[model samples]
Target: MKNILNNVVSLIVVMIVLLLIIPLSPFFLDVMIILNIAVSLIILLVSMNIKEALEFSIFPSLLLITTLYRIGINISSTRSILSNSGTAGQVIQSMGDFVLQGNVVVGVIIFLIIVLVQFLVITKGAERVAEVAARFTLDAMPGKQMAIDADLGSGLITEDEAKERRYKIQKEADFYGSMDGATKIVKGDATMSLIITAVNFLGGCVIGMVQGTMGFTEVLQVYSIATIGDGLVSQIPALLISTATGMIVTRAVAEDSLNIDVTRQFGAQPKAIMIAGGVLAILIAIPGMPKFQLAVIALTMMLGGWYLLRRMEEFSRVPEPAMAPGGGMSPTDIEQMQMEDEENFKDINSVYDLLSVEPIEMEFGYSLIPLVDEASGGRMIDRIVIFRRQYAQEMGLVIPSIRLRDSSSLNTNQYVIKIKGEEVAKGEILVDYYLALEPPNLEKEIDGIDTIEPAYGIPSKWITVDKKEMAEIYGYTVIDPLSVMLTHLSETVKKHAHELLNRPEVVRLVENMKRQAPELVEELIPQLISYGNFQKILTNLLKEGIPIKDMETIMETIVDSSMTVRDLDSITENIRVALKRTITRKFCEGNSMRVVTLDAELEKTIITSLTNGDHGVYLALSPEVMQGVITQMTEEVRKFQELGQVPIILTSQVVRVHFYRLVEQFFPDVFVLSFNEISNNIQIQAVGNIAV
Candidate 1:
C-alpha cells in the first residue's frame, strides 16, 4: 500500500510539472534539461564501466540524457541562429538567448541533444574500457609466455613466487578478473551470453535515456556500479556496497561460535566459504536478466555471499561444549578460527561424534553373557559385544581415528575345553569332561618357545605368551628338576594321574611313582598328557587323510548312545529337512499341478467369460483346478506306451545297447530309473500332444 501511494504521488507530481510548471516556466525547464543531460553524458563517458557495457543499466540512462540534450541544443540553437547570422559565435549567442527564453519545445529539444552526445560517448568509451579490462586481467594471470616455471625449478624465483603459483594457477582456471580485482566465475554459455548481452545493451540505452531525461540521476547512481556517462558516480556506490557487504558478513558470522564449530566439524575450509561468497558477489554485478534491475545486482550478490558464509559455518562443528572434569563447567575457550585457512588442510574429521554406549550380551560356550572386560594386545576382533554395539548408530566417521581399541581386561564369558575318551568319537558331540592334568605351555604360539629361558634373561613380554617363562619369572617352586624320577610324588604328577584315576590300576601305578621320585615326577608329568598335542596330532592326521573315524566311532559307542548327541546328527537332520523343503519348493515354484478335476469343466467356465465362440486370453485355472489337471497329467504319462503317450510310461524303461564281449547287448531288462527315460519319451513331438 505504501509503495502504491508513493508511486501515485510521484506520477501526479510529474504530471503537474509537465502541465503547469513546464509550460509557465520554460526557461527553467530548458536550464534543467541542459544541466541534467550534460552531467549524465560526462559520467557515462568517464566512468569506464563494470568491465562489460551492461545494457539497460546506469549507462543507458546516462546515454539517453546525452542524446536528448544534443538533439535539443541543435534544434533550439539552429532555430535562433538561422533566424539571423551563420558564424559560430553568432549561433552560440542566439542559441543561448533562445534557450533562456520561455520556449518549452526548445527546452525539450535541448534535452534531446545532450542525451545523444552522452549516449555516443558512453558506448564508445565503455566498449574500449571492457576490452582493456579483459586484456589486462588475462595478461596478468597468464601462465604462458613466462619463464617462471623453469625459474622455480632452477630455484631462481623466491619462496613467494612458489607459493603464489598455486593460487595463480587456480585463478587462471576458475575465473575472470576485473580492474577492481573482482573475480567472476565462467558460468553462462555462449548462446545465453549473447541473448542477455543484447537485451541488456538495448535496455541500458533506452532506460539510461529515460532516467536521464526524467532527472533520476540519484536513482541511477544508487543502483548502478558504474555508468556510461560519468565514471565517478559509480565509485561511491560500488565502494559503499562493498563496505556494506563486508560489514554484513562480519555481523552474521563473527560471533556465532556454534555456526563456526559446525563448519569445522564438517571439515569446511575458509577458501570454500570465500569462493562461495565471491561467486555470489560476482553474480550481483552480472544481472543480464531481461526487464530486471541489472543495476541493483551488486547489492544482492554481497548479501548472498554473507548468507552462504553463515550457513557453511553452521554445518562445520558440534555446537555443544564437552563436559569438564570435577563435575563442573570447563574453563575452555570457544574455539575460534581465523578467517584464513591453514596449510595441508584436507577438511575431514573421523569419529565425528559418539552417539551412545550400552551393555550388550554375547553368546558364549554355554550361556549368554555380558562382557565385563577383554584383552588382546595389537589384535582387532570386532564382534557382537564390541564396538558393533557402540556403532549401532553411525559413527559418521569421515576420516579414520588415530586411536585404536584398547584390550587390557580379561572378561571372556567362558573358557571351554572338550575331553575325549581313549578312543575319540567319530562325530563331534558335547559331553561331561573328566578332569585332565596337562601342561599348558606346549601350545605352539608364534612367540611360544618350548624351552624356558632363564628368569633373569627373559623379558616380561615373554611371560604373557609362554607359561614356562611366566613360571620362571614368578620364581615358583613348581619347577623342580628332580620331579622327573617320581611317579606321583609332586602336585604335577598327582594332577596328571587324575584323568587315569577313573581306573584302579592306573591310580596304583601313579601312587608308586609318588613314593619313588617325589621331586622329579611332579615336574615331568605335565609334558606327557596335554590335549594340545593330541589336537595337533588329530589335525595333522585329518589333513594327511588318516583314518581317525574308527577311534571316534568306538568312543561314541562307549557313552550311552541316548546320552551321546552329536552336533552333526542334528545338523544332518536339519540338512535333510532342508533338502526335503527344497524339493517341495521346486514343485511348488512353477505351473505344475496335480489333476483332480476334468479340464472340460474348466474350459466351460473360461468360455463363459468371453463372448460365444469368440476367443481372448483366459486365465483358465484356479489353484484347485490346476492341481486336478497336474494329477491327470501324471496319470496320463503313466498310462502311455503300450507306447501311447501320457509321458512317463512312454519312457518308463530306457534300454540302450550295452557292449558285452565286443557285441551289442540290447538287453531290455537293463534300465536306469531316471529322467533319461523321459528324454526317450519321444522328443516332445514339438506339437501340443505331449502337454500344453
Candidate 2:
C-alpha cells in the first residue's frame, strides 16, 4: 500500500499521457473533467492556507503535472466533440445548456472574457511578481548567511539551528526561482485552452457539414454550445490554477490562513468601516443613483461597524470586583485577594536581588528618556542589539544586556554609562539638534553652538535641523542625538569588554568550543591549565584588543607551552604568535605596516629592568627613563597621526609584555606588536625609533 501511494503521482501522469493518444467513453470523460476541477480547487485552497511558500515547496512540480493533465483532457474532449456530433459528455452538455440558454453569442463572449482575464491579468501579474521575488531572494542570500553566522557566533543559536536556517534560506531561493519559470507554464496553458476551443468549434462544424447530416444553421446551433461548454470546462480550471499561482507568489509570511487574515484585518478598523458606510449613504443624493440598494448596503455596513466597535469595547473593559452584601468584598474573596497580594510581595525583602549588579548599565535624565523609550520611537535598544551582534562576530565575546534607566539627579540632557554599577563615561545630547564634526579644510563656516563629539572628542557644533543639509554640503560629518548616545555606549562597552567576561561567560565559551572540538577541550582544560588561568589569558588578550575567535589554536598553544613553562605571560605570548594572522588582519593595512620600533639600546635596558615577582613579570624602569621613553613614543605616534594612520609599536617577544604594561597607562590606543606576532608576508616599515 505504501509503494502504491508513493507511485500514485507517476501512475496518474502516465494515464494522462495515454489519454492524449487514446479514445474515451463519455462517462470516463465526465469523471476526468470532474477530477480535474477537484484537483484545481485543492491546489488553490492549499496555496491560500499555507503559512510560507516553502511549506508548499512541491507546488512548482505539481503545477507542471496538473498542466499536462489539463492539456491531455483537452485533447480527449476535442476528439470526442468532433467525433460524436458536438457531444463530449453529460457534464459539458449540461454546462453548455445552462450558460447558453438559447443564446450562443452571449456564451461565446463570456468564454472569451474568462480566457482573457486569466491570460492577460492573473497569469501576467503573477509571472512578474515571481520574477522579481526570485531576483531579490537570490540577491539577499549573502546577507542572510552572514546573519546566521553572527547568531551562531553570539551563541544565540546552535550549529544545528544555524544549518537549518541556512538550508531554509537556500530552499526559499530555489522555490522562488522555480516559481519564476512555472508561471510561464500557467500562461502557456491559458493560451492552449483558447486554441483547443477554436479547434473544437471549427472542426466539429466542418465534420457535420461534410457529412451532409445538417445545414449551416443546424451545425452552428449544435457546435457553438459544445465549443463554449468545452472552453468553459477547460478554462474554469485553468483560471483557478492561475489565481492560485498569483496567491502563492504574493503571499507574505503570515501566521493565519488567507480568510482569517483578511477578516481580522478588516474587522480591526471600525472607524474606516463606519466612514465607508457614511460615504455610500451619501451617494444616494446623486442623480440616477439606486437609493434602495445603496440604502441596504449602507445600513448593513453601519451595523457591522457598530458591532465591531461594541466587541472591541467589551474586550478592552476591565471587570469590577463583585460587591458583597454591604458593598464590600465577601470574607472568602477578601482572604483570597490578601493571599495573592502576599504572594506577590514575598520577594520584596530578598537581599540577593538587591546585591546583584548589572554587568553594564546606562542611566539617562528625564529629558533624554525619549531616546530609550520604544513607545516614543526611540531606537537605543535596537542600536545596542546591533552593536552586540557585530561586536560578538568581530571580537568573539558576546556583550551582556546593558541596563538602561532614567536618573533624576543628572542634568536634563546628560547620560552616564556604567560598568559593574560604577560610572566610567558620561555625555550630553541636545534633543532638538544635530552634531556636525568640524572638517580640517573648511569649505564654508556655518553658525551653531560649539561642542565636542562625545564618542571621539572631535570638535563639533550642535546645529539645528534646517542647517543639516548646509553642514553636509560644507563637508561636516552630521550625526543625530540618539546615534551620538549609542556610539558612546558602544565604545565604552568595547573598552571595558574584558571586565564583562566573568567566570560564567568563560564557561559558556568553553561549552561552545567543546561542541566543535570535544577532545581538545577534554584534554587541555583543568588538566593542563586551570579555568582561572585560561580566563586570565583571554582577558589579557582582550585587554589589548585582540580577538580570541581562534579558540582551537589558542588551546593547542596553551597545551604545548604549559609542558615547557608554567608562566601565564609566556603562554599568552605564545598564543599571540599562533594568532599572528588574526592580529595582522586586524591591524595591518594590506601587506604593508608602518610602525614604531624600539632601538637596540632601549630594548636592552627594558630586558635588564624586567623582574619576576609573585604577580609574574614587571618592568622596573626608573621614573626619569620612563618619562623620556613616553615623550619619544608620543612624538613618533604623532608622525603617524600626521600621515593619517594608527600608531603601532614593535619590539622583541621577550620585552613585548613589559613594554605594553609600561605604555598602557599613557597610550591606551597604541598597538604594541612583537616581531613574532606579525605575519611574515607583511612588509614592515619603521616610521620612527623610540629610544632613551
Query: lDDT of all predictions, in order shown?
Result: 0.30, 0.90
Give the C-alpha miss distance for residue 445 in model 1, angstroms.
65
In TM-score terms, candidate 1 sits at 0.17
Candidate 2 structure quality by residue, lDDT tens digits, 112-156: 999999999999999999999999999989767776765665568
- Model 2 scores a TM of 0.80
TM-score per candidate, chains pooled: 0.17, 0.80
lDDT value, residue 585 of candidate 2: 94
Q: Model 2 has how many clashing residue pairs?
A: 0
lDDT of 1 by residue, 1-692 (tens): 98978698456445434432222223543453345444544453333222222211233232333333333333332222222221113323344344535443454355335443333343233334444544655674533323354344334677588667656544432322231122110111112222332333344345545544434443233112111111111222222222222222122123334345455543445455446546555555554643244334544554555666677688776666565676655555222223123321334342333432211111122211212122322112222212222321222111111112222232231221112212111111111111111233423332321333122111212222235554544442232221111111121211222232223333333344567654433533343322333333323222211222232222222222324443222222222222332322322224331211223344354334333234322243355644554555445434432232212211111111101100112221111111221212222221111221
